[model samples]
Target: MKNSAVRLTFLGGVNEVGGNKILLEDFNYNVKILLDFGINIKDYNDQYDRNEVPNSIKELVKLGLLPEAEKLAIINLYTDYHVKKNQDSNDLETNLDGIFVSHPHKDHFFGLSFVNRNIPIYTGVFTKKIISAYYKCSKTSIINNYGGLNWKLFRTGDILDIKGLEIIPVHVDHSIPAAYGFIIKTSGGIVVYTGDFRMHGPLAAMTQDFLNEIKNTLKILHQQENKRGEIQKPRETKVKLLICEGTHIHKGAIESENNVEQNLEQLFTKHPFDFLLVKFDRLDWDRFRTFSSIAQKFRWKFIITEKDAYFYYLLNKDEIHESMKNPNIIADDHILILTQGTVKYRWQEKIRQAIYKEEKGHRLIKYNEIKELDSGFFFYITSLRKDVIEKLNPNFRGAFISSSVDPYTEEFIDNNRTLSRFFRKIGIPSYRVHASGHAMPHHLINFIQSVNPEYLIPVHSDQPHFFKTFFKNSKIKVMIPNKNDRFELKSGIVNGSGVF
Candidate 1:
């Protein structure tokens, strides 16, 4: 503590694909900031524990769902579901600077529900819309129930000054929209955090722009040697610590979103699918655009869940994307809205209360009505449903394409196997044409080489050690910190300790 050093702590995403929780503290400024407060993706089934979270946030900490932080806060506003404590501000008065959310994925922002109301959250504009959509659709949304967030939303290039720390959120391409990597300036020097990004997506230029802006702090190129060992190029940067994500660090087949789109077009053309049931992550708006385009091209009726319909409507206002404003898609004609159950969810019901009559339930297609459409229809669902498919077409000979996550992990393999059997029973074949949201191995190497950081701490991957091999030829140091371990960044030296 004698010299200026930033204390870094890895709470959750040390050696896992998801659940990223990082704490960065500057002793000189007495500033603490938590980055991407995510929960374990595999732990809960994308829902707050109906039993524990309703009772108390303390139970969430005991179950390892919420991190046991120094100070915490909980709210019980829903009188019917849980006891109401409308006024409780224990950790709300803490000195925590703010929380920075990378994106809208549950593994990134799910923990927002438990965050103290007083602590501000910084994120992208569209990310707020995505979170809002999820909050509306999900009945048991713990975090969204906070009613309104104390957010200082920003665009990609906007520089943020919280306390003494300077945070620059750099928009990056991920499976979902409004994702960003942060270039944070600390008293120790500069900290670079690549929040689950890739370079091959359509937004590769944005990543390059980020690199160019951080060029002073990060060397933007790497030189590889042949058998002759010839030096390639000189590198320069002022980056002291680089906390990067290695979700796809290991050797594997990785495809870009463009590649997936091309492959899906071919798949749809090859199979004369009367009805194509596509399953993807709900928040992946890029994937939604891809399917929307495909449906338009094929002249097929595109059916989206009610949740996505509202999100797309909201995204159009801010983004002004052509797909979002596509009358054929959002007008309830070519694209239809499908909600779960016979009645509307809370959000849907609220929409009906609006003064507009035409917008009330325009093209709200019933699940049973799907049987009337013989062919030329594409339906997007979170999961494939056999009953829905049977109702649409009893003979159901179309193909079901899964364009979200690939079957690389054990969990996905098992889930896909079970889904394949279900499809098989109804005379349908399942195809997986996916573009990973994470960076590819070569991209990871390129990132390490470009940043050329003094130390590279890998998180959010099962194979963190795989990065050592990639950085072996370079001076980039790869260190995998254990869960809850603290690494100090001082005098350009990354020394590890037990915990803060």
Candidate 2:
């Protein structure tokens, strides 16, 4: 075994949001762990022209999104387990040891195809099922290859000793099911990583459980250290570092949960239009479930696409089956919404072919299974995407319930007058309705008080200075690490300097 020093480097997701990659090196065992390998969507969109494609990592680095090729090649690369793009090379390629996926969110875990096939990927049981379903539906050839690949699905609380590192996946509340925050135990100390979480609805219980578990673990460590001899130093019990997310730090305080709920209810009651198109993030299943419950209560039929429905069915197959036994369940009221693009075109062509066969007297009859829609209030729940909304005509009145953080810069807000005007002409209302996934400043302060980590390192946001405001009088040193910065951790003290 080596000494008790560990070095951590933040390749991306420091000052800017997205592309979250952190390299952890345990000098005691010569083991390295890569946290999340993700791409900055904004950076990708900025670098690529409408028809152009980037060919190499060199191009990505030149865009100032990723690390230098030489530095990235040092450690094995592992993504959190999302693979949004079909192409394999869209993410960084390396000889990965293993991938510890938090959930099946496209941004968090979609780049798994970039890693070598031999490396094993670990995730929670529900997350594994979701990822498998996604891969099956997408029919990704890269996923099909590698002889079906290795997947180790562990329960939420199980601890694994991986290459001398004790890794524990703690379940957290997020929009998606089976989301996790990892607790990594090294010679240096325990490090808690909050993947993405919110404190609302069904997830409140899970969040509390997580806090309890961390507290218990710290207590146990303390007891063990206490039993040691007097001459021997007492081992630190508290986490040496807390890798917290600051996604909504700059936004400051957010609306209270009760206030947000009241606001939404008021909006729904006031907007008695023909159609109520509620556009929210698709992966936000809790919000979707809330909307579904509301629709059922109002006797308004729930509408969704066949693909989306299928995915939901896969996710909640047992619940659907249980609901089927109840006579009062209104399953038929849920309608399938279809678009006039690729899927619609293909379906129409198939229908036409069947109709033609019937006309040829082939003893075949054509039957229409799909129900025709006349007019009703339709809430289009989705993330705000202009191209998707353009497919629908002006006949349908809709509003966008903005759930995610708006990526608006001061310059764009001041100078881009035409953008707002164009959006108004497009018939989609943008309103902030939902709470954020990442913790706000108050929530962060609460979490810090609960966990009481010795040191805090904020990541996955632009505003690290906001943490200082919350921890102004505390003894726990709050660190704002820069890109390529390395930290030496030993006995609850973190000393580090920025690389650039």
Q: What TM-score goes with each of the models?
A: 0.85, 0.77
Q: In candidate 1, which residue ranges exceed 4 Å CA deviation?
A: 45-54, 71-91, 140-146, 216-237, 319-329, 339-346, 350-362, 384-387, 406-414, 498-500
Highest TM-score among the candidates is held by which one?
A: 1
lDDT per residue for candidate 1 within 1-500, as digits (tens), equals: 24777888888888887789898988777778888988775765444432334356676677776777653221321112221336454343556678899988778887777666667889987787778766655555454464345787988779898876788898887777788889988878678888888777777777787777677433321222222343344434357878898888885476777887899788777786678778777666677777777877878878876666665665655544453454333444577776566445656654433313556465677777777765788877665565576677665557777766544331212356666788788677888888777778888888777777788888888898788777777777778887778888886667787421
Candidate 1: give the clashing pairs.
Answer: 113-143
Off by over 4 Å in 2: 49-53, 56-58, 61-69, 72-96, 132-149, 230-236, 252-262, 318-332, 339-372, 379-398, 404-423, 426-430
Tell me the tens digit of each residue's lDDT in model 2 across 1-500: 22488888887678877667777777776666667655566566667653455554445557665555356455434222333433332234454456677766654554454454445677888777776655544333432222244677787779977777888888887656677888888789888877766665456678777778788778877886687642267755788888877777666555444455567668777674444556444445655665565565555655554344445545554442332222211133443344334434433444334334435222111112112333444444433335544544456566545443234321011212233344567655556666655666666678877888888888878888888777879967788888888888865567798531
Cα error of candidate 1 at position 475, Å = 1.5
> Cα lDDT of all candidates, in order?
0.70, 0.60
Q: How far is candidate 1 from the true structure (C-alpha RMSD, Å)?
A: 6.4
